[model samples]
Target: MARTTIGDEPRHADYSPCEHAVTPSGQPRDPQSACPGRTTRPVVCNQHGDTTEAHHF
Candidate 1:
């Protein structure tokens, strides 16, 4: 992710989505809740190796 400034606000650069999961904001989405994208996709956030609830799957 490249760092860039858009207007007065500083945008935090993000990485591409993880192959095994959905990486939003260059960070993995919490598995305990449905993705904010409003889909039931089985995505996981791997950033920092955080984990989701066991029944998330």
Candidate 2:
């Protein structure tokens, strides 16, 4: 028999839904910022690769 993948399974149950975040520039926020109730997302500078976390009100 052929192996079945998760995507091949029938959708029967409702999965938990989550809301994605967007940055001030209207881009999708980083995955690391997925923490709940977290207002700030850390940004890493590509040039220096320095990461800094900022907090929102």
Candidate 3:
């Protein structure tokens, strides 16, 4: 599947904010594998071994 970044979404990207998107990982999806119909917020994360502005996409 094509993955997208939080701040780099396309012009008409069919994306959604995932609750489990607190880390800079692969495709943003919930534990059940889902997005949209959900909520997200900014959080300080170091999941990738670096301090980055993490949030939902």
Candidate 4:
């Protein structure tokens, strides 16, 4: 898989956020993880990371 920086602008128009900060050793930290309190902001893209919606569950 392609790797991307945490805060850098995406190089591709079809880019998606990696969901979490990479490790110091340079590895994907988690599949569904992100910086703390990041989910509170408005979502610009729903292609990856967290989504903007609610469900009963």
Which candidate achieves the best lDDT against the true structure?
Answer: 4
**Candidate closer to the true structure by TM-score (higher is better), 1 or 3:** 3
For each candidate in turn, the TM-score is 0.15, 0.19, 0.19, 0.21
Highest-TM-score candidate = 4
- Per-residue lDDT of 16-51 in model 1, one digit per residue for the tens? 222334454433356664333322223334332223
- Order candidates by TM-score, high to low: 4, 2, 3, 1
Taking all chains together, the TM-score of candidate 1 against the true structure is 0.15
What TM-score would you give candidate 3 relative to the actual structure?
0.19
Name the regions of candidate 4 deviating beyond 4 angstroms.
Answer: 1-7, 10-14, 31-57
**Which should have the higher TM-score, number 1 or number 4?**
4
Off by over 4 Å in 2: 1-18, 31-57
Candidate 3 residue spans exceeding 4 A from truth: 1-12, 15-20, 36-57
Model 2: per-residue lDDT, tens digit, 1-57? 543222111111232222455555434467576423324333434333323444222
Tens digits of per-residue lDDT, candidate 4, 1-57, equal: 554322232222224433555555434456465333222223333234333454222
lDDT, ranked from best to worst: 4, 2, 3, 1
Candidate 2 residue 41 Cα shift, in angstroms, is 22
